[model samples]
Target: MLAAHGFVEAVEQLASGLGVSVLVLSLLLIPVATELPEKVNSLLWARRGKDTLAVGNLSGALVFQGSLLPALGLWLTPWRPSRDVVYAVILTLIATTWLRLANRSGGVRPVWLLVNAACYAAYFYLLTLR
Candidate 1:
């Protein structure tokens, strides 16, 4: 708990130094910290030729986070959709659609993942506009 609190305090200080709100900083950084381990595991599995495990590990985390987090947020919070939330949802849908189309066309090539990265870049750009 102390470590977590210190981590957040550091993030807050960094956000202050960077002249951005802690919310924005957290949005930018926290997901990377949270998701990096799963992504690394998936990459390792893929390199080992465990394609199913690689995909499952990545998709399972996405599925759980996508469904449960929103459900909990809706249940626990007032659930007002801000501009940021709307933009994020729209971007997420766009990325999902892009991935789906890529899957339908053929296997997901490494290059195809660039679209998702572009979506994330778009979100970061959008954040800057606020």
Candidate 2:
């Protein structure tokens, strides 16, 4: 979370300095770049055979992206979410619930990966409509 704040601060500073269409470009890079540290941390854990930590990091990211990030949007911006955004939020809630159940039962089958792909497609479709 602090890393995300630092990432946002760095991007804002760069955008402010550039003073052009810098925000558009910087925002595009921010997500992937901000993930660098987490990726490295996960990779190191995996290399040491600490698989659970690596997996937990990935799962925590999913939860953060789905929940906390959207909450931040509401707090930081005056713009209201569209109906599609509301639907996305509801769908995310359902997905997270399913994830919790899977985690509890150790029932996250390989076939469940297909469901993830479907959800990803649906997310983009909703975004296009928005």
Candidate 3:
């Protein structure tokens, strides 16, 4: 907990130095940092043709983060949904639905997975427009 606090403080300082809002800095950096390990593991597993394990690893992390963290935040904070939050939720639904449909219709192609990256890029673009 203490280390996390220190890391957050360092990120805030870096954000200030870069003239970036802490929220923006965190939105850009935090998820990538937190999800990196899962992503790397998934990639390695996929490279080894352990497709199910790779997908399971990534899906498990997503499920935990997507559900539990948001539930905890909602329970612990007087959180109000902002425009960005709404946009994010909408994009998440869209991406998830797209993936599900694609998987149902056929196997998910590499090109189809690019849509997820596009969704992330779209979120960043939306942030820049704000």
Candidate 4:
């Protein structure tokens, strides 16, 4: 609806805060919102004592973010991303790859969360540098 209403840019600008507030807010919010439904599903599964189901949902989410969505975005967007946008995407790729690799080791380690935190920090730092 925000996109169809011609307010995508406006909402994104407001969310990204027009250079006054850090654009990291937009980046951080994106994954959280995207993962929220999966998290909700996992939480429901956990409540039913289905820890494995929760883990499966998390894995599915990681795959969706890592592969499907980004591929679709690239296929759909008409123009190439700017250098800064590309750099940001590179950061995302790095973070997501690291996450997938970490998940392969059989548990969510503290370091993975820390890496994500560092990614968020890097996003804010880049916004500041911008």
Candidate 5:
């Protein structure tokens, strides 16, 4: 995911130079950019018999994005996120809540996957409208 994020950052930089709007760049770049490392890491971790690390990387992105990244960004500047960002943040929170609720009841169910897919759809839709 970290490596994927770097690619997104590169796209954002190039897009900015082309006078592309942030919203459009974000919408276009995020899906492709975020998935590459996630998929690779998951596959490699599974191959190495380190399923825990693979899962951790998946969940850790949420925590890192929700808490660490923005907090640090806030410290650097008086940051005020745009409305699309707010939507994205809300989507993440909702997804995390669903995951947490699932975990509390024992093992995960099929609904968790459905809910996650819905969340992704929502985010993608929101991005497209931007």
Candidate 6:
């Protein structure tokens, strides 16, 4: 925990020095750094034919990170989210609900995948906004 905190502080300081947005850096780099190992593990599991395990781990990580990271930010930081972040969160919730509804029939359809891709594009658009 201490090392993670130190790393975050270091990254924030570096962002400050570079005149970059700390939120942007956090959104871009921190999760990628932390999740790479799990992603590698998922790939290895897939190679071993444990498709369920690989997918479960990937989805579980997404849910855990999506919920916990935002909750932690609300708890640990001033919690003054910019308008974009709030919109993104709302969009996420809506998309998640829509996905749940779509999954009720047991399997995903092609249109659902396209909608999810569009949602991802929208989220990335939110992030890339200046």
Q: All models: lDDT?
A: 0.88, 0.71, 0.88, 0.75, 0.78, 0.82
Candidate 5 wrong stretches, greater than 4 Å: 1-10, 13-46, 50-66, 127-130
Return the clash pairs for model 6, or none: none
Model 6 worst lDDT window (10 residues): 83-92
Between prediction 3 and prediction 5, which has the larger lDDT?
Answer: 3
Clashes of each: 0, 0, 0, 0, 0, 0
Q: Model 5 TM-score?
A: 0.58
Estimate the lDDT of model 3: 0.88
Where does model 2 exceed 4 Å of error? 1-33, 49-72, 127-130
lDDT of 6 by residue, 1-130 (tens): 9998999999899889977778657766888998998899999999999999999999999889888877897899887778666756777677778888889989778788777677767876776676
Which stretches in model 6 have alpha-carbon errors above 4 Å? 75-78, 84-130
* Runs off by more than 4 Å, candidate 4: 1-10, 16-25, 96-112
The candidate 5 region of ten consecutive residues with least summed lDDT is: 27-36
Between prediction 4 and prediction 5, the one with superior lDDT is 5
Summarize candidate 3's per-residue lDDT along 1-130 as a digit string, tens digits: 9989998998999999998767768777888988999999999999999999999999999999889997998999999978777777888888999999999976899989999889988987887786
List the candidates' TM-scores in order. 0.72, 0.52, 0.72, 0.64, 0.58, 0.62
Better of 3 and 4 by TM-score: 3
Candidate 3 Cα errors over 4 Å, as ranges:
41-59
Q: Which is better, 2 or 6, measured by TM-score?
A: 6
Cα error, residue 24 of model 1, in Å, equals: 3.2
Error of 3 at 67 (Å): 1.5
Considering TM-score, where higher is better, how would the candidates rank from best to worst?
3, 1, 4, 6, 5, 2
Winner of 2 and 3 under TM-score: 3
